[model samples]
Structures are given as C-alpha cells and as structure tokens.
Target: MPSLSQFSRCLFFILLSMIVTQCADKSVEENLADGIKFTEDRQYLRALDAFQQAVAKEPGNPKAHYSLGGIYNLMNRLPEAEQEFKIALKIDPTYVDAIYSLGFTYELMGDKEKAQPYYDKYNKLKQKWNEVLQKESETR
Candidate 1:
C-alpha cells in the first residue's frame, strides 16, 4: 500500500539492519572458548589458531590478546609475547593477568627494570582483589 519511495526506504532500512547484525556477530567469545580448550590440551598450534580467530573477530578483546601473549611466552617468543601483552594492556589497563604476564615476559627477556613496574602493579592489583574478597566474606 505504500508509495514507491516509502517502500524503497523501508527495504533499505531492513537490509541495513541485517547487515549490521551480521557484522556484529563476530564470535569472539566462542573463539576464546575454543582457544582455552586447545590451550588446556597443550595443543599450542591449535590454540594459536583459535586465539588468532578470536582476535580477528574482536580486535579490542583483551582476553584474546592476553591468551596470544601467554602462548607466545610459553613458546619463548618474548618480543611477540611482550607486544601482545602490551596490546591487551592497552585495550584494558586493569587486566591483571596481562599485567602479570607482561612483567613475566620482561623478566624472561632479561629486562628487570621494565619488569619491575608491571610487577608492582600486579602486586597492587592482587592486594586490592584480596581485600575485596575479604570484605565480601565479612559481609556474608
């Protein structure tokens, strides 16, 4: 019953919405789950593939970057590990695991000075978490 222009406009909006929804279905969480499973199985290459897929899906996912960094650290690829950890940290500065891993990566690379600050941050964050847990337990 609509005019030609109105029908065209409605069709365009519907198509646009579908495209946006499809693009937004990036599967970052699914890939992360697969990566964790592969990593737990000690299948490094498979884990890498999964994590890489996760990163591809969501470049801003700190967990994907952190998982990639952890894999690189295990493989003795210190520079790549450091870079991934830095990326994770850049995406989420409060990601404690990434902060700890960055310190550990620097230590592995023999950069004690670089490692020290991260270690301090890791310790501070751990302490904060512990205190939070303590307060929660006290209240309950």
Candidate 2:
C-alpha cells in the first residue's frame, strides 16, 4: 500500500491534470473563434496560428481543420491546405466542404482527373443536402 503523502500527491496530480484540461478546452475555443475572426479580417498568418492551436487542442473537429485548410488555400499553400482538408475528411468522411475543397485544391494544382471525381461527389452531396434543407423549410 502507498503512504498517505503518496496518495495525496497522486490526487493532486490528477486534480492538476483536470484543471489543465479545462484550461486547454477554453483556450481551444478562444483560438478557434479568433481564427475565424482573423480569417475574416484577412490576417492569414495570425489566423493560421490560432487555427493550429485549435486543431492541436481538438484534433477531431472537422470544421476547425476545414477552416484552417481554407486559410492555407487562400495563402496559396496548396500542399498544406490539402493535408488539412485530408485530415478534416478523415475526421468526418461526409464533410462536404472538405471534399469540395480537396477537389478544388487538386484543380489549383492542375490535376484535373483527381478534381473531377471529388467535384462530382461534391455536386451530388450538395444537391442531396439542398433537397433536405428545402424539405425542412417547407415543413416549417
């Protein structure tokens, strides 16, 4: 069995971890919001840093990755943008924006064949989603 002091230290470490995690979560939210604001303000580098922090904190968020990909694309960093888009698609395979943007990235790279398949997929998904939204709008 462990000593009382050892148990106390262990508990402290756990509590500290919990606090740190909470702080990380808040920072991620702040970073993500700032990223979008910076992007809209045309501060691409600042936006990239903020988005990078957000993705580091929340690796599973497809939207964060997608937005970062957009900033990279706007900066004409095609490879980085494609990587981010690929991550977004991995996180959420049905992410339409990621698929479309990946397709667009290929187009930017002058890879017409790769772009065509993704473009067709984006069109089909966009149409399907639009139909769903229209039906919902009609219902309401």
Candidate 3:
C-alpha cells in the first residue's frame, strides 16, 4: 500500500491533469462564441484563431465555416473567404448566408460571371424561406 503523503500527491496530480485537459479543450460552441466576441471587438487575428479552432473541432459544422469565412471577408482575404464559404455550402447546400457571401466575395474579386449563379441561388432560397415564414404566420 502507498504511504499517505504519496497517495495525496498522486491524487492531486490526477485532479490537476484533469483540470488542465478541460481548460485546453474548449467546446466548438465556446470557440465560436469567442470568435464572435473577438470579431465584435475588431480583433481580427484573435477572431481568426478562435474560428479556426471551432472549425478544427467540428469540420462538418457549416456555421463554423461560415463564421470563419465572414472574418476572412471582413479582412479582405477574398480568396480564402470564398473557399471557406464553398466548404460550408458543400456541407449544407441550402446555407443561404454562405451562398450570398460566396457570390459577394466573387464580386469583390471582380468575377461577376462567377458571382451571378450563386446570387441567383441565394435569391431562390431566400424566396422559399420567405414563403415558408409567410405560411407559418398565416397558420398562427
């Protein structure tokens, strides 16, 4: 059997390791919230880091990709923004904001032809969403 002092030290180390692991491992939603807060503060680099962490934690999350793309767009990193938005759309084809942002990013890149189809898709989706809202309101 272990001595009392050795057992206490071992338990203390185990608890410390658990706390450190939990601190190091932020949830995807926590990272996303941090990114949003950083963006609101105009801390672009910190926002980028937070968004990247969110993406890493949940690569299939369209919201994470969309939020990352929005930061890139605000920073005028149009090509990267376009790529992230495309990834988001790949994960969720009906992601309206990503569709609109991708089109806007293309326009910013001076590629009007490329932008048009995305813009058209966004408009169609928006129209459908509005119709759904209208029907819901009518039922209520």
lDDT of 2: 0.92
RMSD of each: 8.0, 7.0, 4.0
lDDT per residue (tens digit) for residues 1-140 in model 2: 89999999999999999998875766767888898899899999999988998888889989889988999999999999999999999999889989999999999999989999998999999999999999999999
TM-score for candidate 1 = 0.77
lDDT for each residue of candidate 1 in 70-90, tens digit (9 for 90 to 100): 988887889999999999999
Once superposed on the true structure, which residue ranges of model 2 sit more than 4 Å away at CA?
1-27
**lDDT by residue for model 3 (1-140), tens:** 89999999999999999998985699999999999999999999999999999998899999999999999999999999999999999999999999999999999999999999999999999999999999999999
Regions more than 4 Å wrong, model 3: 1-23
121 Cα displacement, candidate 1 (Å): 0.8
lDDT of 3 at 4: 100
The predicted structure with the larger lDDT, 1 or 2, is 2
Ranking by lDDT: 3, 2, 1
* Model 1 / residue 64 / CA error / Å: 0.8
TM-scores, all candidates, are 0.77, 0.76, 0.83
Query: Residue 124 CA error for candidate 1 (Å)?
Result: 0.6
> Between 2 and 3, whose TM-score is larger?
3
Clashing pairs in 2: none
